[model samples]
Target: MDVDYVEYEDYTPDNESDNNITTELPFGSSQPSLSHVLVAINILISVIGLGGNSLVIWICLWKMKRTVITTWYLSVAVSDFLFCAFLPLEVFYMMTSHWPFGLVLCKVTSSALFLNMYSYVFLLVLISVDRCVMISFPVWSHNHRTVGKALGVVVLVWVLSALLTLPSLIFRQTTVRGSVTQCYTSYMGPSKHKAVVLTRFICGFLIPFLVIVFCSSVLCVKLRRLTIKSTKPYKVMAALILSFFICWVPYHSFVLSESDLKNHSVEVLETGLKVGTTLAAANSFISPVLYVFIGNDFKKILKRSLTSRIEEAMAEDFRTVGLNHSKSKSMEIVKS
Candidate 1:
């Protein structure tokens, strides 16, 4: 899977003759109503994601002091914002089933999706590890953690994500079949397809998921040892992890199923994929919402202006995990 608007109707070598036959609409044209609904949802996601992530980026860049946490949030916001920014192109293609944009844009837009996927997951992993290190080894974190180092990590993430996304840029092409111009990935063979899908699953989801889980477990154990009363941090961390898992697992699962197409129906897989992709797209916007609601006090969230709430959320003391009274006081002094 390319994760584009098109329904991936794979054909074996036996029927490769019919590969270019663009009979169905990009997303199940059999039912016009369902396609319209998906289009509407995608449009909504694009609007909210772009607006919310832009606000986060602005705050991180201008309204707050640059800390390691701010650097991480800013990088994640930029990645999500870029993904949302290109969603209109996808929406346009979905509605008209046309690829008027040249080949360069076709490659760029398709690759942007995977770039966001890889960068977002990699940043989450960094955040998890940073938090774990902070709690588990506060003195070292206080001594060594810096915004410059975080920026270096962010650059590494972008480089790695772009390298992983090269397949989309190379394999994606626009083709004219009859009257419709379709933008799709052309894998060389089943082995190549399997390799891409497996790489995406392992790198994009599985390994990062394991790392996050381990970090979360460590944080939970360390937090239990502390006397902190606030559950806000707990809620925020859980929401981030759960939302990423819920929104992405379906997409990855359906993509993985593409390898064993003999056991599944094409129509069902197509529908599942469309739904999964939408859910995954939704994760881009959900992070900003989480920052606003879960990162702040419920009463204050309602009373505060949006900008103030977001600023406060980003600048919140959620990062501090007090180990003991004396050490906590000393850490606060060191932070100051």
Candidate 2:
């Protein structure tokens, strides 16, 4: 999804000055009640996302012994939790249409949001590739897919995400308009804005999306010949990929429409854009549901207690890692 059209701040690709940053829809517009609705939606999203992702982070980091998959899940949960942390500020901005937060904080919040977004998406791509590797070359994956290697990849993703988000931190400024202050990205010129948007679309969305789709498709086909035990993880991963698309495609579509052409007078597209923002924010919470609670094993354990579920997830992680270790040793012995 284009971060430019994100709900919190106005996205005016026009060569506007730092002081004239757009915040809300036009004055006396028909959607006076829209702000109230957005506040409610964002509040709900914040509550759910914060609660769910916090729990996932705790379980993955403390309860489970580290594994490649657990490490990825931990990074994702941390990112989502941090992202949702800023939603209240968004809610406040929506209600009052003012940014009490200064320039530094504005950049911080915006950068954090995008940082997590790219990190989460890339992590999903990594998971897809990991699953594909495990399915395609089980022995090779067993030997190579260590927790250390996974952490290195995650660190690299964080660095890349941070670099990508540098533009938001640099360009986003807090400008005072009349009595109200608004925080927004201040593009230097038309060409620069276009370049940033195009780069973000390709690097942040399109490339990671394609990688995930291709890897998931191949893993799905390979799952047909695998045992049920091996198949379950791949199935869960496929569901995760599907849920990501369901959540993000609307947002990116709105971004594409807004970026490439003039805004149409059609009210439906306008309404769809707002709905797309809400859904995109909601994705932070939806991930935990799809990745954790969707499985029957998790649900059954969760019924007993949160602790039980954590224990069950941890056991599963260790069990999988232990099996891979044993398999790798056995293969080495056989080859020797």
Candidate 3:
């Protein structure tokens, strides 16, 4: 869609603050209930995620640097955590019913939001390939997939992901076309209306999502074909793919539903949209928790960190969020 250039945060571009900040986009209005719910959920997730992702970084980078995979996952955790840092602003927006962080913050926050989203998704794809390669071509991968090399690939991904999300930042500007302030993506001057429509969907959501889906599918297939000898690897990969689909299917579906402009049945769209968006955001916080906590003995250690009650073992995961579990994990990897 041709994103309407509307100012959302009560800041006009001409007030000298907007100098060059863009914080507007197409056809989005405030939904108080949805925003409130999203903000609360986002804040809760962000607050906890900061700790979890930080733990992941500490473990993978400083405690367990023996494998190349650790480096890749550590980067994913950091990126996802950084994304979580901006969740509070989104929470504020939800609570206030509008963007209150001004134009520059809107741009910076939204840019980080998208960069983190796409960066992690793409990183997951890379992880899939790395796993597939390790299975299908172990010697080649071992000889080539050192931490340094993996770090380089991850760096490239960050650069590429950031570049791809640049347009989202570029097109966002808060401009007061009328009395109401709005945060929206503003397409400059006259341009092909249909082009922006297709571009927005195809480029913004569809292509990136499809990229993850396609790569994940192929990687899964490759893993399956290579691992019929044992079902465990296949099961793990299948779980990963299932997780990705569960988290992302609704997200892409919402984009598809919103594909058509002038489909002013926005209330329906917003209702449907918020559900999927929150679900996807929930996945952001849930991924590391499920992957790392379940994949390891963190729960047991955390339970020891707590009072060591039988009830506590059953409720072990709660301690990762500072619920007072006793068994703690320590990684002694790199300091710098």
RMSD of each: 10.0, 9.8, 8.0
lDDT (C-alpha) at residue 328 in model 1: 48
TM-score per candidate: 0.83, 0.80, 0.70
Error of 2 at 171 (Å): 1.5
Candidate 1 structure quality by residue, lDDT tens digits, 187-265: 7566666788899999999999999999999998999898777867567767877888899999999888866777987
Error of 3 at 212 (Å): 6.2
Better of 2 and 3 by lDDT: 2
lDDT of 3 by residue, 1-336 (tens): 111122222223443353233233232355555555655677778888888877667656645635666666677778878777876776655554366568887677767656766676667667767776776687998788887788888999899877767766776656453554445654342232234335544654566566656665766677556535454433444454466557657655655555452453555655566666666666556656765545443344444434344444544565666755332321111111
Best of the candidates, TM-score: 1
Error of 1 at 63 (Å): 1.6
lDDT of 2 by residue, 1-336 (tens): 222233212345234535334333421134658746766877988999999888777667755667898888888888889889987876676667677889888888767657876888888899989988988999999989899999999999999998998888887777676787776665655455667667767887889888987886787688777766545566666776676677777866765665443554434555666677677778788767865656554444344455454555555566676756645544444343
Give candidate 2's TM-score. Answer: 0.80
Better of 1 and 3 by TM-score: 1
Model 3 misplaced regions, further than 4 Å: 1-34, 98-100, 176-181, 189-240, 297-336
Q: Of 1 and 2, which scores higher on TM-score? A: 1
User: What clash pairs does model 2 have?
Assistant: none
